[model samples]
Target: MISQAITPRELDRRREQLVDLQRYLADQEREYAELRRRVQGFIDRYVATLGPLYMELDALESQLYCAMRYLHEALARNGLDTRGPDSPKATAMPQLLVLPAGAPLPPEPEGGLIQVGPPPLKTLYRRAAKRLHPDLAPDDAERGRRERKMAEVNEAYATSDRARLESLLLAAGESMVKVRGGDADAVMEWLRSTERAVQGRLRVVQAHIALLTNHQMHALGESVERAEKKGLDPLGIMANRLRAQITERRQELYIGQRLQPESSLTEAFLRQREQRLGGGLSAARAP
Candidate 1:
């Protein structure tokens, strides 16, 4: 019974990760478009005479190509389709899914798409804690106990357990508000907070892994060496490298926040002027 209760919560967590991955891809696409617009300005003003501008343009194009590839790979990893004929280029591109012409895109799923809903174990814990906490206690020892129970309330809330949130506010303490109605702002706030907390925990775990200098890492390295000695295939190494590249691109998409352009074409033309004259025009013009 305990395992059955726990399974769906784990699935919900997995779904949240995929949603973040999608957001990351979208941001990458926006940034790529901005870069292209900027480079197009240089292309217009210099008309291919600006060597440095050409190089910058090439780099931006390459970045877009790589970003698209990363988006495609991420979609495949999540068992989502990368190829939607309507947005052929966007298939592998991050930040926008291509829908067939005249067809409206599907709305982002509510809460998320991975699990049934919030975990049931969380409410059970919150109820138990609320009954014991010092703040809601019938006496002094009970109050001290309640203070400690506050930590449990926080943990449950952190997991986006709606039932637990309601239970914490309702059990004994009095000033309770029912959370029956779903608020968009409240959901978004919780989602962002959860994302930050998870990322923080992941960083800590990664640091610990890095610090395991001579023990686990060295042992793993020695095992890999032994395997290579027994004849590891060159193709496997190449495949691993490709996987690494795709992962790095996904990470970039996550960290790099993208802003939509207000005046894309104008910005492009301005960039071209700036490129022709090293960011500003000279007062002395040669005829």
Candidate 2:
């Protein structure tokens, strides 16, 4: 069996391939960030505009359902409804949709084990602290900036986040790799581990991007954006439409409330809602 020889040429090729993957990963992550920002912004605006109206509409529906249910029971007490047992016991509570959370920006790993120098994580943390510590700042303004960064460094150190420490060090213009010399097999192992970590992050970025793209809200937001480009107020238009529905539902609730327990409209109203609300609200018969 021939022992696999790690050559300089082979190492260079691996470095180049890893660089390409890292570049692609960075681009994907950037795109994901921007996409999340836009989609979340759209959702926020939409809810701000239309959310109250929807709540009002649902409340009106609930009142109508309750009114109808009371009348239905009244009819049953009077032996009016021949339509037997199949009313929805109660209204189904609607579930709300929550936005997908942002994916964490993982750092690319960089370090050296030149004859096993001090523990890498501690070394990286010290490097980050030295660079980011607020006391090193020459001015109050710079000190404030450094303070925030220093907090991050402290947090990274407390949690033993090697990659985070390395990232902080890199951001402060500190070099992460400090190899005066190292074994070929060790270098190969480091390279493979880094590649695997990067590849795993790439998958996370891709999946998050897919999740944002495929969300129903994304398409709605796109439509709203396009409408805005054309000088159309799609959200405003939707708000107006909802207001109209609210006014109409209010009138319907008034009528339902005014409806005599034996009025023929009670039966018709229940029939109409049976299909709309899965007919579980109540079954009623009129005189």
Candidate 3:
């Protein structure tokens, strides 16, 4: 079985194929991250705009049901079959009552009991990478498309937005967390580490951009008033601007502030975010 080895040309070709596959894999990873970012942004935007409507709708529906029940009870006492045989009440009656139009609805459960699926580490990584794998691309134009997709995924993963990450994990059917022997500390540590590794650098870049914008706005006090009307804190913006200015002189100042014994960057960001969003967002500490 000691046959001669393959020719140099064949060996070279094999190497090239391997290289191509490696490049493709890298591209896939980047694409995955970008997809995650887009998903997170969409979720954020949706929650921002329609979360209230959902809350309102829930409340209204609850009130409507309760009122209808009271009304039904009253009618039953008075022996009125207002509900037709086709009505849902005909099968199993619920108490019915009525209230004025546009009246505030009774409170309902804020949200349903959510059933979280397993975490997805592998599936997301693969799907994301596949979407932008250069090997899968047939031509230069297609390769370029992959590159762009890869860039977005990279950026999104860099932000470490876990809500979107979880969504991606669900879609991909992978778990970031292991279930065999649950070590709470280890799991939390990994989560924290992953978040910081992904989100920290991008957040710093975003902060820089925000600082520049704030500085410009401070120069025009009129914009400050507009921000106030939008429920923004002028003083806090001013403070951030001041911090930015100081950080310019000492680049580590921001890092130091975030690394304080009491606060992590994620926690600080959430606190600031809550102040901006009327304290409606979930709270989590960053690494």
Query: Candidate 1: minimum summed lDDT over ten consecutive residues — where?
Result: 85-94
Candidate 2: C-alpha RMSD after superposition: 14.7
> Which of the numbered candidates is closest to the native, going by highest lDDT?
2
Better of 1 and 2 by lDDT: 2
User: What tens digits encode model 1's per-residue C-alpha lDDT throughout 149-179?
Assistant: 6776777767866565666655645332222
Task: Give the runs in model 1 whose Cα sits over 4 Å from its true position.
Answer: 1-24, 27-31, 40-127, 130-132, 135-287
Q: What tens-digit string does per-residue lDDT give for candidate 2 at 139-226?
A: 9999999999989988988998766776777778975354112455666676787888788888877887888888878999999999
Candidate 3 residue-wise lDDT, 1-287, digit = tens: 11134333443454455446445544544554454444444444444444554444444434434443444344444444333111222112111121112223222222111112233444444556665567788999988977776665566567855455445434444433321113333333433443343344434444443443344322344455577789997656544564554344243233333343333343343334335435443332222
**Residue 10, candidate 1: alpha-carbon lDDT:** 57
User: Which candidate leads the pack in TM-score?
Assistant: 2
Output the better candidate (2/3) by lDDT. 2
| Model 2 lDDT, full chain set | 0.71
Model 3 TM-score, all chains together: 0.26
Full ranking by lDDT? 2, 1, 3
Work out the TM-score per prediction.
0.21, 0.61, 0.26
Q: What is the lDDT, from 0 to 100, of the residue 84 in candidate 3?
A: 15
